[model samples]
Target: MEKNFTIASLEFCLSQLKRADESVVRKAITSGDGLSESSDDVGQKLSEAHKNAVKQCLTNADKLATLHNQIDACDKVFERLQNMLCSFQNNLGTIGEDMKQLQVQSLDIHQELENRQKVRNELSQFVDDIVVPQPMITTIMDADPNERGFIEALHELHHKINLISSRGNGEAVAVNDTIPILENLKYKAIEKVREWLLLKIYQFRKPLSNYQIFQHQLLKCRFFYEFVLNHEPAIARELQDEYIDTISKMFFTYFKAYASRLFKLTMKDAASKEDSVGAIDTAKSSGISGFFAAKPQVRNRATVFSIGQRNGVLQSDFLGALIVPHAAAQNNQSFQFETLFRSLQLAFVDHYSHEYLFITDFFLVSENEALEIHSKAMARAVSVLLKCCEEQIVVNWDAISLHLCICLCDKFQQLLIEREVPDVNGYWETMSNILWTRFDQVMTNHNDSVRMIDLKKLQNQGALDARPHFIVRRYAELTSAHLTIAKSNGKEIGPKVGALLESSEDAIEQLLTRMSTMQTSHKNKHVFLINNYDLILGVIDDNESKQSRIYAIVHELEQKSIDDFVEVVLDPHIGFLIKFVTECEGLINQGHTQLLVRYNDKISTVITTFNQKWKQSIDAIHSEVMNLFTNFRLGTSILQTIFTKFVQYVQRFSKIIAHEVFSSNSACSEMINVHQIMLEIKKYKPVY
Candidate 1:
């Protein structure tokens, strides 16, 4: 019962005691015989235990009350927390609704901003595209055309007008309203440009005015023409017509005066009828007395095709000198026909090339329009120059000079092409036509001159002699010159050249026949014919292309003449020898051995006569040939041919002498042999 066993242990002891029966306790007490330490001690222990048990129960009850009070306070605290959590959940729900509403408001605000931005952009574009600034209008109305601001302003106005015209609609009423203002400004600008351009163009009409400078100035503002053309085509047409008229008239007057003054400086001694190839001076008397008459002493005349002396006419320095009045006067010189033609053409080419470029650049026209404009501008000047050329070509009898003029025209045309000048209007083509026409006419004139030659007049004038006729030499030179020109120009002059050659050949044949009539004998006639033909051949021998048709023809004629002359001259030297050989061969061929035997007696005689006289015959023939033939080579050639014929004749006769029919005569076998004859002919040949 001490400190180790408190009220709860006491209660445990009392509960155990109570659980014991009272009868057991009484019995145990009454049966003292079995009882140990008495019932009194047991009672006291139970009593103390019971008091302790009760005190513990009262303390346990107070502790239970305190635990119950603490449990109720926790219940109150948990209830208050639960109410606060409910309030928080309700606030959270409210906030979720508020956030959804704010999100919607923000999206609406952003959508509003995007719509406002689109509207602002559309407004800005409309304003920029349709607005025409006051500064631009002022520039178009009053600004100087030379100022850069004016062109810029005009460009802006044109753009705005184009935009309005292209996009005019119900929504673009503002843009359409600007059309009148832009049109007024456009007209004003065009008027200003037109006045300025017309002033510059009018200045070209002034004498000694620097039109090139003005043209250069106009080129800077060439865009003005394009603008006017686009806005008002009628006004553009007027300007173009005015420019063409003014410039064309100026060129006409300028070229007309220049050509007139230039024509005076042409050489007065140009080729004439007298210088013609077939010209004959009928006034002169024939000085010849016989067929072998000496050729008249001819003056030293310039060769027909020798144009080197006339090259000064094509010199650039000479062209420049002739253009200047002072220089031309100081030189006091006359130019050839080609020089005059070249100068005038060169001037035209320069003017044309410059004017063509200027018109195309300044007008901004198409190529066809530019060409038309150029043709109109140059029409008057071209007509005058071409007329002058035609008249000069008609009168001038120098075909060589005319040919040179044609070459000059071709060269100038090439130069124009190189300068990129278009020939759509046929200016060069027309010029070439005129030149070729005149050239062919001149050629025809020459041909006609040859065809119309008077043989009687030529013979009476002593123009025909041992030498080649002047006409033949001139014809050869002209043919050669024409061939050279054809080759150089890459043109086909064959038909014309052939006609000329045929005419000349006919004339030469006629002339030779007439001269042959004057010969006293057949041999002399052949000699005269041979001499003239040989001379003609020699004249054309220097031609590089020996394949020329004329060369072949003349060569053939010469050969025929030589053959005739050789037969005529050689027949006398060995006529009987050839006849004897022929007669014996005929008798042998006819199977007449007896007749061949009879001819053998005449064979030695014929051989002896030929041997004794062949040298004298050769010497006489040589002397005659040297005296008659003008070409010494031809004379020697003839002599050699005669000597060869003489040898052949003697060899034939010697062979006839050695024939079996004449073998009975020992003297025939011992006669001079062909070897001895060759030895004798060797002495006559020239050493060279």
Candidate 2:
């Protein structure tokens, strides 16, 4: 019945329900017996009441049906919900067990964290204890902290600090917390080392006052530098400067006292040596040879503190010994030594204006008023100084040589140049000679070992490529300056240049001739003479190109030299033959017909003698001549020219005596005689 509750079926059910209610109302009205006043009214009221009761009963039944249907739907929904809740209950039990396990794990983690914290705290304490094993104050307070023990303690401290740092980012927070403490320890350790070093220096006792304390202080400084400062060069430099300052004060005091003592001792030794020399002179007056001979004397190192002490304490003196020669030595040690000595040199100049240091004396000419009066001592001193500057190591060449040159020139000006009756010619000549000598030495031997300065090397390495030519140009400048000065003074420079050229030519001629004579080769001797003579001629020809009077003289010299060489070499052979022909012509002109017959024999002998000598000379230089002249045609041309002259001379003689001296009718006449000599000459068959 309840399944018929669709919209159409419910409308039909509601229609039937309304009809039943109307039927019950009508029955109730019809059956009603008692009516209160009016029967119809009473019946109508009773009918209404019956209809109400019936409607109430019908409404209750409909409501009961709807409630029963709703209760059954609710029962099915509750049954499905109970099945779903059963799975949830099982899951909840499992979740509750998991929650219990999580609580137990939380407790275990909390306990482990506490244990780790305890371990970390213990480690922190241990690190703190190990980072500084010995109290720094104790070490600082000690009079002399054992260096080994102190270093070990510091090593341990640094090691522990490094270990803590090595814990890395995990312990970065911890390490940062401990950094200040570690830095404080390092600071205290460095301070202690400094204090200890100072104490050792203060306690240093040296009876013999010398540079020995400086060496001791250096050792301590190195210790402070490497051990305390480590790689902190800034701190090390500060300490080093302080130490050097203290030592410099000490050194100056000792140096002044030592200098004073050395001066007195040197004066005493000089006096005693003079007395000893006088005694030796008296003892050795045996002969002139003995008197002139040099005496061999032993030098006492202690007595001699002045110059020439090349092997004594003065050689490795305290001031000089302080210098250490190396790349870095220039900065600290060498700088200090230079500063000290520079001050000393200045002070010496102030105190001893007249007295010169040995090096200064060697380089600078002394102010001698007597040199104008022809004093021998001043000349000897000048010679000695020149020799010393050249040979001794006491003078620095680069620094002192320039000063020495200026001093020499100034002294020359004073004594010779500025004189009232100065020998201007002699002065200019001497100065010019000096310039020439200097130039010649350098030009000839600029590459020799004695030249310590290598301009070629300098040019190769220097920034400017022209550095090597500077010295060469400097010589030219000096020469020009001297020449100009001489010209201004109206001195006779022409004679000097002429003399130099003559001397040079003489030297060249002597050398070439000597070389020619010394040539032992039998063949090509003339060729060898030609090669040597030509080489010299080429040099003189080059010199001639320079438009100077000197070169002009050399050009004249060159011509004379060549003419002389050619005469010496070539004349002996052909000159004699030419002379023979000329003499024969002279005889013909004088009407010596008898002599013409004998002339063939005499001329033949002369030609034979000249040919032998000429052949010998040619043999001497044959190989050299062949090597020297690369052009065979040129050599042939030269030979042709020489022999053609001889041929022409012979031909001229033939023409002169042809018709007069010989005829076909004459038996054993001069023409037949001359023909025999000509045949002998033709046998030579000169190739050129």
Clashing residue pairs in candidate 1 are none
RMSD of 2: 24.3
On a 0 to 100 scale, what is the lDDT of residue 385 in model 1?
A: 80
| Model 2, CA-based lDDT | 0.43
Whole-model lDDT per candidate: 0.74, 0.43
Q: Residue 657 deviation, candidate 1, in Å? A: 8.1
Give model 1's TM-score versus the native structure: 0.68
lDDT of 2 by residue, 258-294 (tens): 3333222212222132221001112333567766766
- Badly placed stretches (over 4 Å) of model 2 are 1-140, 152-195, 202-242, 246-567, 575-688
TM-score of each: 0.68, 0.28
